[model samples]
Target chain A: MQQKQVLLLTKSIKEKAIKEFYSKERPTTLCIADLGCSSAELNTLGVVAELIETIENARQDLGNGSQEYQVYLNDLPGNDFNTIFRSIASFEDSLKKQIGSNNFGHCFVNGVPGSFYGRLFPTNHLHFVHSSYSLMWLSQVPIGIEDNKENIYIASTSPPNVTEAYYDQFEKDFTMFLSCRSKEVVPGGIMVLTILGRTSTEKYSKESSYEWDLLATVLNDMVLEGFIEEEKLHTFNIPQYTPSAEEIRFIMEKEGSFILSQVDVSEISWEANEHYYKNDLPKTAFTHYDFVKCMRSVAEPLLVNHFGESIIEELFKRYLETVQVAMTKEKNVFINVTVSLTRKG
Target chain B: MQQKQVLLLTKSIKEKAIKEFYSKERPTTLCIADLGCSSAELNTLGVVAELIETIENARQDLGNGSQEYQVYLNDLPGNDFNTIFRSIASFEDSLKKQIGSNNFGHCFVNGVPGSFYGRLFPTNHLHFVHSSYSLMWLSQVPIGIEDNKENIYIASTSPPNVTEAYYDQFEKDFTMFLSCRSKEVVPGGIMVLTILGRTSTEKYSKESSYEWDLLATVLNDMVLEGFIEEEKLHTFNIPQYTPSAEEIRFIMEKEGSFILSQVDVSEISWEANEHYYKNDLPKTAFTHYDFVKCMRSVAEPLLVNHFGESIIEELFKRYLETVQVAMTKEKNVFINVTVSLTRKG
Candidate 1:
């Protein structure tokens, strides 16, 4: 439901933060890949824009005409690489000219298309890694939270406590993340990770998603108005794996290599476009309350049951109203994102 | 001039910071004092509050309340000791009622009045020491930086740089501070220092001071309008010592034996109280920018020689108007403060 907003927020963070890592006369070869990058047409420019700025700044720092970089764009198979490539081609010439053709060259571009959940690159190959708005979506919903009838995970509930099963899954995933990066990045490489986090452990269960407060309000409103049955609501949960700061710190301590350099958390409002729809009432209600599409995965069985035959039409219809509601509300939901850990030698 | 502002800022910081070193359960037959404690109204209470919180949280770790403390309250001769004595009287009854009377019965309190820079108490008599907001003022300004006629140090523009002389004097004073504490505080004791600092070395120059800016602007305006000499304006400088964060770190490192646990730098707003005169100005200008006073320390001598007393007053009247004009246009200033380090154990 917050796909567009999430993308925009991530992009802005990327653009703003890249400057800090780039300096003149010392153009750093930044090798960044967005993990779990989904197939969404929107917000692609934001990420590209951020990378362009970073590369250009690095070239400028290299001075006169002496800088070069090998750019690697990585994402899952579902992401629209064709569109990304086409977009990069359009700006490549001007960038080369501005950076001085002799001193700089086209971002020697290549795509590494695969799941970031496992190994994708050679050992000690990257100098910098950046990922945004993606970690919360677990590779799979935790098996412990799964229900037999629907074969779906119903997130957390009334009392705030992370189901031990969910926490165990997150710990495993985080360890996997460390191992993957530890293999790919050399010692002293820099990483910028902005992920969803929880302030309290107890709050995690009752409000299951990393952004439970925000999504819960939307769901409760839907139930009160009868758009989504409270029983059906029990079948869904935000696809999330949020760890508290303390838990994350504890994991880092156990991992014992990465040093935390900076931690920043802020509330951001995402932008979305609202539009007209034909079916009016049912479509509008569906658009406003269907958190399921964002929550669904290709592997999750609930997607098949919920969408059945007219999935595309229904998903499109519901998205418009959600945007309208979010716009009318004068603000959108928020997530707590923390950036921590510096690569260590 | 900034006494009240410093007082309030220091107070708020104290309430939030951990009081691990100061506690009632810390057995000390020796009487400890926070001379120039400003108001030791909190001398023992601060310790007791920390002890209670710590003991309650880790009763097993502490075992029992067998440790007793004797706290002394001391300040400059004219300080408000009645309040300190009264607060002690009230806390005594409360302490006995809260913790078993016998557990805290050994505690004693007394007040001493004198300059901390001199022999305020007998030598080798104290077990712990704590002082704040009193270190910056020298027992007397160095014999230099003063004009023979005025007797007040016109240190504003004495040296072009932040001045090795200023740093030399600070080192001497700080060493005195440590030596004084070392004498009274037993071999195995802890001392915590929280002081103001600047993140950059740029704020110490005459050209940077707002008063200088105003005086220059007024001089320029007067020059353009054919009222004052440009050559005369060149003599003015600002008197201020805002050491950079690195400089402070260096000073502590030089003093040696201090382990830094946490250093928190917060940009404080002088407008914490809106009704105060300074609050009427931008917190930055008032808190960080008082370049006029800084300018006075340097410019007055030059003005006295060039413009003479009567014309100088007239020019200052116009300059004051220009300052108000500048301040009304823009207000907050930024200062960096670090609270870090532990005395070498």
Candidate 2:
């Protein structure tokens, strides 16, 4: 899903956001910031290369020979900045080589350790901003959700207040994210945000409803086996949300800092089908294991922090078995939403 | 010398540089960058705290209650940033407590891993810049001085090219430093640089002459004792220089980006003299040991890299005995020069 979202950026967003910003501003130093830039350097550096290429093309069009880039890779303090910093010297070396050093735009990389919920950069300091698979993470789990028992996210079995509390937190967090970026980004700046979200047509929809059900079911299975405490399961809630496209549009309207230039919504299948495999492949395919790995990469840290590390292997084992049974009869896909915005003057 | 330079900042540099920048710009988020912010969290954070207080006090003087601080702590990419980053959370917590959090100026700290010899920030993005004991480090060892044999620096017994090579490197490095900073700092921005320098009156001064000679002396002693190679001792030259106040002033004039507003020169004792000794300490004093430890902190890594790790224990052991003998007959003090600069329009 993220790969497709990145592809969307290369086709549409690269042309609109960066090209427009460059033609309008012609800033000698084009400053870009990547919010929630994970420890994985490949994804973050790929986006940077794309943005730089867009700027390079724009400069070539205008007969501009000179420009520099200052990229701020931001994340929570615990993110592995050392790994990224270690990779930068070589990253810059290759970037210079790929686009001849003499003609290429000089690039500077920095790590800004903080949350994007509040202001990160100084006023009118940024030319472009981006976030990928990061905005779904709320500042925290929603308040007044104590009765959201035995479930880590909103579900069909959840009470009405549970959904309301989660949405309330999302509205506040997404609004704050927009308002903060408005101040940091220059007028006519651009921001491209890719969030996992449902289509606006799904009215009264609980996004990730069945996904949470399987996770909760796995925890209950463990509870029956005397592995995890029932009380712990009752109190735990994922500090995340999957909003509808309409909910995101509403936040932008309330914040009133950015014009929604474009939004694209598409569903991505969770399981890889047999179409890609060759005839010689193994027969007892663990198609469901792929889903477990994907979900575990996102949720393992939170679970380990909340429930302790001892239950992880058993928890995932039970989750894999449950997902295998569910995969045959049910459809599972993530709603990938990409939105591009222009900072209002 | 560095400790005194930091003290000078608390008394004079803070009031002149930060206060002037704050009063002139009235920026809501005052940006400050510390070039060569070493891994010592105490020293870097101390400077940051002083900068914030200066801005906080300036804001208070005008009855302004809202302000934010964004501090960029810069160092070479190889620096031990993990230790400093690990300490920031508690540091911020204490800072917020020290100044009441309700209306105190919010502070943001970021680590920029790079060399300061080139442009680090965006054009006109920095408000104030400062570096302590950092500018004395030349970008590299000057070329064509392989004949300055057996000695690590310019010495009385050395050829003329050795002195000329060291001075040439210092001038080029310093001028480049100024020009690069001029592009990044805003017009009327302030910079306070504390360099370990000579008093400028001496026509043939060899700053750190005896110090490096003593180190060379120790290395040669090891070489004679069959512990190190003679070829290695002759090939190594320190990638550092201590310029006189006059030389520094000349570079600023040549760079022509900053106006020299104030200059103060002071000498700091290299050894712990009688004045600092307590009543109950051991009588078998390692007074020369103080200088060895200080120099080791700065040069140990370079030594270990060039000569291998095996020689360090024995080399320093000989260095202490040589320094102890030299201390009885010589005067050793570091000449500290502090210059305040304002970026010219």
Best by DockQ: 2
User: Highest TM-score: which candidate?
Assistant: 2
RMSD of each: 28.6, 3.6
lDDT of each residue in B289-343, candidate 1, tens digit only: 3434434533666567666665666666676566656656665343435443444
Q: Tens-digit lDDT track for model 2 on A121-227?
A: 87787989988888989999999999988777887667889888999999999999999899899999999888877764532354446676889999987888889
Chain A structural similarity (TM-score) per candidate? Answer: 0.68, 0.92
- The TM-score obtained for chain B by all candidates, in the order given, is 0.59, 0.92
- How much is the lDDT of residue A37 in candidate 1? 48
- Tell me the TM-score of each prediction against the true structure: 0.39, 0.88
Q: Evaluated with lDDT, which candidate comes out highest?
A: 2
Scored against the true structure, residue B124 in model 2 reaches a CA lDDT of: 81
> Measured by C-alpha RMSD in angstroms, how accurate is candidate 1?
28.6
lDDT of 1 at A206: 28
Model 1 DockQ vs. reference: 0.00
TM-score between model 2 and native? 0.88
